[model samples]
Target: MTMFRTLYGMLALCTLLLAPRTLPAQAAESLRTAEGTQRALPRAPRLPRTAFLENRTLVAAQLSPAGDAVAYLREKKDSRGLWLLPAGGGNARMLVGSTQADQLMWSRDGRWLFLRASRVLSIVGVDGRTGVRVPLGGTERRRVMKLDTSQPAAVLLGERVRAGTGERWRIVRMDARGQRTLLREDAHWIHDVALDAQGRIVALARFEGDHDALYRVRPDGTLREVLRLRPMDRLDLLGMQADGSLLMAGNPGGNFRRVMRLDANDRLQTLHQDPRGEADLDEVVIDPRTQQPLAASYRSTVAATYGIGDAQAVVADIARKLPDRDIGLQAGSGPYARWLVSERAPTLRDPRWYLYDPRNGNLRRILDDPGITANAPKEATLAPKIAIDYTASDGMRVHGFLLLPPGVDPARAPLVAQVHGGPINHFRAGYDGIAQFLANRGYVVFQSNFRGSTGHGRSYTFASNGDYGNGRVQQDIVEGVRWLLAQGIGDADRVGIVGHSFGGYSTLLGLTFQPELFKVGVAGAPPADLGWSMRWLVEAGDQGDLPDRSLRHTLQALSLDATDRATYTRLHAQSPLVNAGKLQRPLVIIAGGADRTVAIREVIHYTATLKALGRPLTLLVEPGGAHSPVDPIPREAYIFAMETMLQRHLGSPAPEPPGQRLRAYLRENLRLAGPEFAEFSSHQRRNPLLTDNSDAQE
Candidate 1:
């Protein structure tokens, strides 16, 4: 899920519930005559830019184990603080005075709340009266792997240590008293450690060349190889079950992942699998006390859950009663459960925390997001995404989601091919703000899950391993657009391409290699040169601080390597920087000033090259932004710039005039390197903020 999707859910819930009522009944009746002939309604009004970009008032909320109190992180203006509220619903009092603390977790006994701030792990009392920070030695990074809430004080941690040659992983156990003990050490790269009910490390997973090896730890500390996955298979440990077996999700011989149990004898027993082959078991709900699987969820077109036993079935029944929402087991155990459910279809909005007490057959709403509800459009106005499949030019079946603007003529609607970031990541059915924002502005959006995308199976994911830019992956996207145009759903002359990260790379490829296809291109933090990115990864591995072996191996899997001359040449040939002269369409490139993944230098070089070629390009540099623009300022600015660019190139209807916040962001963030920036600024100046009586012109 995108960061915006998660943050939008955390906003004030009252805004959602108190949103203005739908069009009046008298207005609706007047639209239709006495003979019941319907009249076409005016297009929905455009919401303020702040409605889509601002941080939620409430950042995060979590219910305590015993359900007596709820701890939440609240954001106001520039600062965020932690607060605790009684479960009965009253004013919340400040707990953590500092705004730096986040990722709140409660101790099993509900005595302490664990939080991380400035790379330090600290705990605060439930009463918000006392607290202590765990003393971590040196600057080496350490991560808390597992908090055995059952043990209350014991926390399993992964610490990096210098070994004979490369860096190794050591498992350390710490108590609330700040006492630390070295539990286990491994020469291999340990990814995760699982503890049994007794708080003993029973299993540890190590990353090998292509697959992960699961090792079982005996009482005497001897290691035994229990389960090893195939090249493309993956196993995620859910923890040790009550019967001393390990519950895991993996695709051993099947196309999709299934929840299964690996017994002490190494025999695997399948617990649950999605009946629809397209859906993969994404998450498993387990009982924290018993370590037993209660329910599992799969995401095919949309998310669906399967209950393991009767107790979970009852909860699932209640979840079904509330249609088009993703139900989550938040806290509490057994019959009395607290669920965090969010609207999953039509438009992704309205997330509320609910408490279900089976003893009284009562399901009461605990907390609701007011901001999301208030900003959400009515069902009739919002666009609906339909799952689509089309055969690629290479005979490969590709999947995608097509969202058409509501009440618009499909044949003439301009289209935006919005590509997702991770070329490896697959698109799921949900509320995507970027797609919705474009659709709302009178554009059809098509998000393609091309080759190498996950969720289908091993074969589909591995198919695009070596076919990065010039291969089948780009063809899949092209075919999807062609499919849309063939179906009379998109205007070929007004089509635009936009994406971030690898998707950004794809955007560049679309304009450079397939120049005739896209009228304009918007790339965000894209790796202009693949060979440079691979070399950076190789250097990081040599530094021996972070685990770069897996990254290096993945690069090799994709036939990308800086050391190999032939492979390096192939990658360079496919890079956008190498083909800057081929780009004929108008382009806008956005880069993060502080991005570590794709260095700012690469973006600067790419922009410089585009300038040298005199290509129509605009550059926006987000100061202090990361790989993806997370802050509201940069995020909104990016959207505002893209919306303006699309209107210019795609002949789409103009969105509402930019507000003060958006206008300031554009002036501050837009880089004055190219001539295109002046044109963008001029366009913004011409369209002043709209008045209530002013008619919006395209």
Candidate 2:
């Protein structure tokens, strides 16, 4: 907290702490012009850099419960608000001043739209009324448990409030009419809830410090424990089945989630597990009328939805009607029930919604958001992604998605391995802007859901336990690329890596440990040393008691123990920064100057060390950004830098030059620029540490 430490702590990172410099007017004007000097490569489709950088929600619409209208949350720049409209696309009943909300759900009665913006919950009447707003306490966390359309306009809300030293869950009911009722309050956190057809709480699953339990809500309003699981096991109360049993998803550690039935006598029966036994059962579709899981989704090589009981035929019917697109079904109210079907494809930037009457097999397209479609790249100009799987070096099977540029020969395309951020997330079937942008430039994009990634069953996720920093997990990615290369999917010699956060760390590892394989790396807010980052997280990252997902416990299970000295030693030995001398490939690091997760100081120290070693590296800092820069200026600058480096190394497409504002940003915030970025900026300042004639080394 002292000024002395704040200013001088990172002073050693550079030989000189030069004052900020503004770009010359001439340099700025030059940058405002299109295209860079390196136009020797194949010309790619010209799209605005903003096309790849826009993260704003274009629009989200949900089919009304009555299946006669659609509720729209429009976020177009000029039209930023909520609106209610008819199913046939008539006039909109706009709700003024309600521009942003975190999540959206329709009220049960189809008269309102439930919106949550941080701690505040608001409901907008479809009649264009001002609506009712309810705010929670400042320091509380809430999860919307359920919104059953068969009932009234009430919601089952789980509010987590600070209790003495720990936190407790207060389950409450809030309706569109502004009525609030306390259903039940418990000491542990309520993770899931199941309600009956009449809007009554059937059961609730709570996760405590060392164990989890499912409690049945008795008729007298008391709670009875029906099922309990010890630490590391999973328990989720999906809903109440028709046979008076509690439908659930649970796993006894090891990551393999299974669907089961817990009868009134507390007898458990296995219903459905991933058929391949390698993917977790996610995306449970609940019946609005019966309040039970009708279908569930799992991801292996690709994502697939398996229906439960009578729902299997309905899902099959939808598949026959709508082929080649991922189907996301949201239940709606009607005679035979209408399904709000969202059709998603690899090239479709936005999910195309359809009103499907399962009874008569009737389907109709409903959404046409101009905010996205107006700026979205042409469908024919975009690439297509396919689910792929390959065997790794250790004989374990790995699955991922690959995006190929349209009209480009797979045998000749350059390769870019796009690693995902969460060591918990995976590359799935979707329209990814980054992958599409890369593919649009004629690079064969490979994203491997390496070991330690979720979506695949628990065993695969737990397979990388203690293997982090040891090359097993990284090998999965490398092996996948090698397999693809063998299939003539990409050029073996022309390969680069890019990612953010953990994926960023993987990018650095590829450049450092496998420099001969990967020619360049672009890391966004990378944690240079995994062990150090974990240690910092353990000490300073958590606000209160560590949650299950905090990596306090999961880190030890997935990789190394954060508090163990031996674990730190092993992790540091394999970390990129500690092995910076091994990195011979070009690297461009884009960092948030004030990143709390991966401290900016860590990035500075790593780049400084590389500079001392005379390594070819560049550092781009977004001073006002955290973790990653969401603002267009810094983001475009990053894309430009990455494209330039890749173009220079791999013969990829040339990038459009940074715009006027981005040029100024580069001149000021590009703390370190190398020869790769020489064309974009007049100021190419290499550290004195990089030259042998210079006196300063450290």
Task: Please list the C-alpha lDDT of all candidates, in the order they appear.
Answer: 0.68, 0.70
Per-candidate clash tally: 9, 3
The CA-based lDDT of model 1 is what?
0.68
RMSD of each: 9.7, 11.9
Best by TM-score: 1
Task: Give the poorly placed runs of model 1, Cα more than 4 Å off.
Answer: 2-42, 67-69, 85-93, 134-138, 163-166, 208-211, 252-254, 337-346, 369-381, 540-545, 655-665, 672-676, 679-698
- Model 1 residue 167 distance off true place after TM-score fit, in angstroms: 3.9
Candidate 2 contains a number of clashing pairs equal to 3
Question: What's the lDDT for candidate 2?
Answer: 0.70
lDDT of 2 by residue, 1-698 (tens): 00001100111110111222233454333322211211222444767767776445545667766667777676765446776667655766766555657567877677788887666778777676656777754555565666744357877777777778977778788778778787777777677777766667778777655566778888777888876664445677766766678877777433577778888788877778777666676667776556666777664444566677888888878866766656787766533777777776666667677777777788877656564456766666666565555666555667776666656666777899999986777777667878877887778898888888876666777788666773888888877777667555688889999999888999999999887889999999888888887787677753213442335555656656657888888888899988989988889999986787787667777888788899998888887688877666777887887788888899865777677897788888777787887655575666443343333212
- Give the lDDT of residue 256 in candidate 1: 80
- Give the worst 10-residue stretch by lDDT in candidate 2: 1-10
